[model samples]
Target chain A: MKAVPAASTVEVDGEYRLKREGTSLQWNIADESALEAALRLKDGDGIVTVLTMGPAKLEAALKELLARGADRAVLITDRRMAGADTRATAAALKAAAEKTGPFDLILCGRRAIDGETGQVPGELAAALDILCVSNVERLEKTETGMRLFRRTENGVQELEAAGPLVVSMCEYAYHLRLPGILSMRRAKSKTVEILTADDLELKTGECGLKGSLTKVITMEAKYPGLRKGPKETDLSKATEQIQAMLREVRP
Target chain B: MKEILVLCPHGVDGGLLSKAYALSEGNLRVLVLEGEEQTAEGYGAKYIHTIKTTPPDEAAFAGWLAEKIQSWGSTIVLAPATIAMRNIMPMLAWKLNAGLTADCTALDMAGEDLLQTRPAFGNSLMASIRSLSTIQMATVRPGTFRPVEQKANEPEIIPESGPAETGKVRELSFTEFAGGKPLSQADVIIAGGMGVGSKEGFEKLAKLASHLGAGLAASRSAVDAGYAPFRCQVGVTGVTVCPRLYIAVGISGAVQHLAGMSGSEKVIAINSDPKAPIFGYADYGYVGDWETIIDRLLHLEEETL
Candidate 1:
């Protein structure tokens, strides 16, 4: 799970990337839903490890995840891993998962609120040589593997898949549980395991901006809903005009 | 000239196919997985390769597509932003060591480079991206472009061998949601926001929508507040709709809300706040209580009926 800049607090720099410095951060809502799914799927002796890739400041966010029932927290951060696109980011994540994993399931939000590319999970799955499912809204533990209900634009796809696969979840699929006082206290004593690029064995060109294949050419502030329309504060006139426009629409 | 490849997994999205045709400038090759060759030919694709899938598998499909794309000597690839493509494209990009932009709203070519434009930062910024790899890829929004009205071409249809690798995930069943006309295809939409107050308020809007023979939509705030379901939410996270007429009832237009419905041809906003940002986008603005405005509109509709 990653702590993204709050939607309201998102500000773009001249280069078109989000200015993450001093920005208010919150759990990417979709990732929180994934966390919720992980928590619910935890059976006896099952551990939910919350992992994220970002700067050193993200340790606080990981600690908060630890408070929210995560048995362990992993923070993959390094100075060389800045400006990584989805592919490069996935490469770094794939390395971290290889170093610390060999687990049953890996869950992520369908897309992050910031970039919203939603390509990381698939790329990471490719890097790890695993199956990946996207747009999964609901899932349940079956005798063999799991049963997943994936919501798509046309219909709902039902799939029976085994573990050792990556799944990306919808934002509102599961509501995250809040941290209890006792859990918060316990979380304070736990140290967040930090993994740098060197620890992951990511080569010099395969870590950060240099590793990314996509480049943002330009970014412009989108002035949304810029239609020139006449306004009327008069209730009677407004109703009359709306009635007229309604008549024009083909049934 | 390098080949521009388009993938039609479920079928050829006419709008997406036409957009690819425009970008490729008549030189287009399409790979249809379980889609009809005639539909692709109608969009003026010169070469169409039809392939069958025993089961949908992203990893296996990506590996196969990567090899095919390389063999065809294609430099750019485009697919509709459907669930399957969204799942498969990233893996394909990884296998090919390519870069991909997701849900691109616009596409252009700048001196052999594919310029992909999409919303960034919750639709507050528009970013134009380019891939540094040999092959550039993008999954476009389904209905972002208009379908081509051109006649069919005598395209060469080849049957390609399917992927041999079987996936672990097994398909069970698919349940298609039954409803009236979907909001995306609706000619007119009556959308409500938080100012609509509750589920009961959305019911009122639904009544008006039924009366006017229109679709019902909701702002993200309304959906988040539990007044409406995510399917009805209109915003960046939800579906992007372009309708002939859109009515914003009790909606205080946030940029996120506007991102979804801004493509609407005509807008009518009804909010108690005269300064609601929705009014700025509306062709007609009414300042009053939603119940009062809805009641009047319904009364007017009833009288006409």
Candidate 2:
């Protein structure tokens, strides 16, 4: 799923603050990497469907994913779904998956750029009752099962997983192929199926901001006074420290 | 009398136990696997349960653990917010229908309710969360709390039965990624971001990294823009580095990106945007054109040659 934060809401001075009201109507690059990875795994077979749950205006983002080679697209939009937290959002997306698939595999971007929670994959994996691989760089097929090269804190570890698993791709793990004119034309012609709370049977009271586990209490801008680090303006001194620090670490 | 249980199969960080102790008022138990019994004992946990289980069947563990939590009537479950814990805890949370906060930076007891503070929207916003379900669960971040010192008195060690559903999934073989030095171990790092412009732009930073014998890193935008490899990316979604010196070029700092590298001993940043968040974190700030600043650095190197 692609999410854009309202850039205009950002207020930067000596401090960092943002109002997440405006949203960009485009694909999140991390999710786009996952989409591209899904295509690579497709390997001239299997269908790739892109789904996003948001307001009615998010259809365009789904269409863009379609142009990039998704076989089908789903726009699961409902007012009741608004302001859903990570758990609720994962539940809604998982429920949408149920409606669209008895799918053998599910792929997601590492984390949403907006939320930066990195929670949905595990939550969704739990929701679907499947093995969730959080950090995969590459994927391969085996005779009995599939193999994935997963990134760990130290290095990448290869793991064997079967279908009916959810995997989230690391950022820039795979480069997305540009949509050709033919695929773009087909995407333009296709009618994106829309699913509502009625279609998914989502309980209104069970979702939205009210259903969320957390709440933002207040906001403030960061300030110069807040920072205690001594700022150096001398390039020569900075360069010397860099060299000394390098020697210290390498030695 | 242990109502709070902390699962530390992957050993334990001081922050995890310190938070656990603070919330439970020094009355919490730690759980580890059989071989890790001594390691958990060193952490000064009053009661440590070392389960004799070894299968990596997370499903079985989740089920067994969830059942155990219900039976014990444990109100709070804490795990290291590392990727390893993340893999299994959410599954457990799902099974228990519990509310869980990921990467919780703060955990406090407010009249029996756990007050959890976590970063949201790429650290652009902070959200205080509480679990509404039967059990409140949270994954605490590392380096936030100090490690409990090992005491002379030994902790009580309880041997636990392995999950019955184990051995369902077996490990066949293994191959670790054969690659260059990872960002986490690098002494000096040169990180890039969207301000680097394109592939051509990133190469300049890479050249400097090579010259300085430093590892290369990128903010989320650079990786998303295809200017750098995913392995070299550094941010909330990428690897964290504790490099002695971190030089961020054309990188606007985002909280997500800062989460990964804010621990660097010293930082120097060059970005065109005067108000770029990178400057706030940097020890040395250069608010100017990245291209021009980079060219000058390269020219100085050439002159020294």
Candidate 3:
């Protein structure tokens, strides 16, 4: 039983890159343990395509994916798609995914550090009209479908979902791989196809501000320079003050 | 003249009404839309419209509210920055062609413009944004305003009648957790976090809270670690508490947690980490082991009583 390349990288050019040294391809950005687990389930025949949406600034993130073992990379970028909110961003990404054709599975970080709304992957799942398994920690390839272990409030729960599903990686999902010098150099020379709005034929309104449903009406300073005087910290006096404050509430 | 409509979710809790009334002085006339049960009189408001809707059909309720706003001839609208208000605000704002700012901690009358303040970028940065459109909107966080108190019973409560639309989502079932004494309502709150070490540690904290009659709260990490239920969590994803005396026990004080409870009247942090962010916001911070400190506090409470 050959181990699969359980790690694939999505590049800025919207291509999936997998390491040639590995057989099975893993599709998560975080959690190397989960990636190794994913490799164990593969027969070493799957192709890993790195997919990403953004300008060339995301090239580094994509190259890192390649170093981790993605077979190829795909970059989806367009000037018209700047300043997109989550809904429009999901729409554009879904369009790019449709253009690149199909896949047995799609994976994404549960949420981006920027705009911690955690709405993109859910919105993307809705846009693509697929089954979404959020916060998946492990994946096991099965004969008919895939088995996944997801984090829940109480504990980890297992679920079986058919292929062609989207899984959002949680905080503890998988550890991100470190890109070796050799893999980093090789990723630089790798071919990454950059797809624009024209390539996806996305409507102008559906790509950026026009397609976004939410808008920021106003922004204001929350905390200015601290105005409160320094606190008195005599332990006995502070305890008395706290007790006095508590009494005022009940009374 | 450009007008902004504000939906007072709690219908001017006297505390909030006075603040809105103060902010609406001069050319700004705050048209407060509230529930029919809420009294609108004595707030010095130019106009008051009360909405009629029950819980469980808020989407339809929002559509109805949007329709009323559409006919009200207002360019911008605002809502109280409460959890219930936020649930329907975005959809209503979207329908009204207006933008919305959630959890605005501060708002000001900037000449002809309205400046809103909110914590952004993981609460590390504060952003002050001014909307270009005439019909800009935002939801102000509660307690952000200092409500002016005055004795005047009769302001006005106008009852509104309209055809409610069908809603997209249906309420299947709901469970209401007994929230104990809400931190906002409590004068003293004893909050625990993951740094407490174990469930036994949390029990000790609870014993201290019991002795002091303070409400028990937990940080997100504590809740995530199963030390406490989600309802007891205090952070951005949980409840915003403004207790008079907040006793933070063994909490590392992540920014998200700080954003929710920083407005407390006074914060006393008990954590071993001298460099913990909680210390920065604490009125008094004890840099020592929580176990020993909690045990001592409990003993002192018993002996003093």
Query: Second chain TM-score per prediction?
Result: 0.86, 0.72, 0.79
Report the poorest 10 consecutive residues by lDDT, candidate 2 chain A: A219-228
lDDT leaderboard ranking: 1, 2, 3
Tell me the interface RMSD of every candidate, in Å: 2.9, 4.9, 8.6
- The list of candidate 2 runs beyond 4 A from truth reads A6-15, A43-45, A213-251, B52-55, B150-154, B164-229, B240-279, B284-305
Once fitted onto the true fold, the runs of candidate 1 whose alpha carbons sit more than 4 angstroms away are A10-21, A233-251, B33-35, B52-54, B164-167, B180-187, B207-215, B289-305
> For each candidate, what TM-score against the reference?
0.91, 0.80, 0.63
Error of 2 at B115 (Å): 1.1
Native contacts recovered, each model? 0.78, 0.36, 0.10
Number of the top DockQ candidate: 1
lDDT of 3 by residue, B144-189 (tens): 5655644444444566764354332223333333434545556688
lDDT of model 2 at position A248: 68
lDDT of 3 by residue, A1-251 (tens): 00112312211111212123423343332333434344344466875666777666556656666776665778888888876765677778788788776777777665443243444554565566555655556677767677776643224556566546666655444455567777677777887778887888888887777766555554333431222333443555545655565566654
Local accuracy of candidate 1 as per-residue lDDT tens digits, B231-291: 7888767767778899999999986788788878799888999888888788877788878
Q: After superposition, how far is residue A246 of candidate 3 from its true place, in Å?
A: 3.4
